[model samples]
Target: MENTLQLDLNRSSHSCREDFSEYVAHLQLHMALQARNLVPNLTQAADSREQLLQETQAEFEKLVSRQMR
Candidate 1:
């Protein structure tokens, strides 16, 4: 009887470990997808900022040229 109980406990422990491992794998996948989604949005925002800076610089140069004339 004691040996049977020990076997049951071992099985339960193994099952729990498997469950935890699966949960961790799923969490990692979810995080990777989220990061993937964020990359394009971040890239777009950076592109927009760079475009705005270029426009501002061009306007400044135009203003300086007018003042000199």
Candidate 2:
């Protein structure tokens, strides 16, 4: 009886370990997917900011040139 109980406990522990491992793998995959989705959004935002800055600088230069004239 004691040996059977020990075997059962071992099986339960192994199952728990497997479940935890699967949960961790799923979480990692979700994080990776989220990061993949975020990267493009971040890149697009950066590009937009850069373009706006360039336009603003060009406008400022034009204003300065007109003032000098």
Error of 2 at 26 (Å): 0.4
Query: Against the unseen true structure, what C-alpha lDDT does each candidate score?
Result: 0.63, 0.63
Rate residue 41 of model 2 by lDDT. 29
Error of 1 at 66 (Å): 61
Residue pair clashes in candidate 2: none
The C-alpha stretches of model 1 lying farther than 4 A from their native spots are 41-69
Looking at candidate 1, what is the lDDT of residue 60? 51
The TM-scores of all predictions, comma-separated, are 0.57, 0.57
* Per-residue C-alpha lDDT of model 2 across residues 1-69, encoded as one tens digit per residue: 999999999999999998997777666656555644543322233577766755665565465445433
TM-score of 1: 0.57
Q: Write the per-residue lDDT of candidate 1 for residues 14-65, one digit (tens) a residue.
A: 9999899777766665655564454333223357776675566556546544
TM-score of 2: 0.57
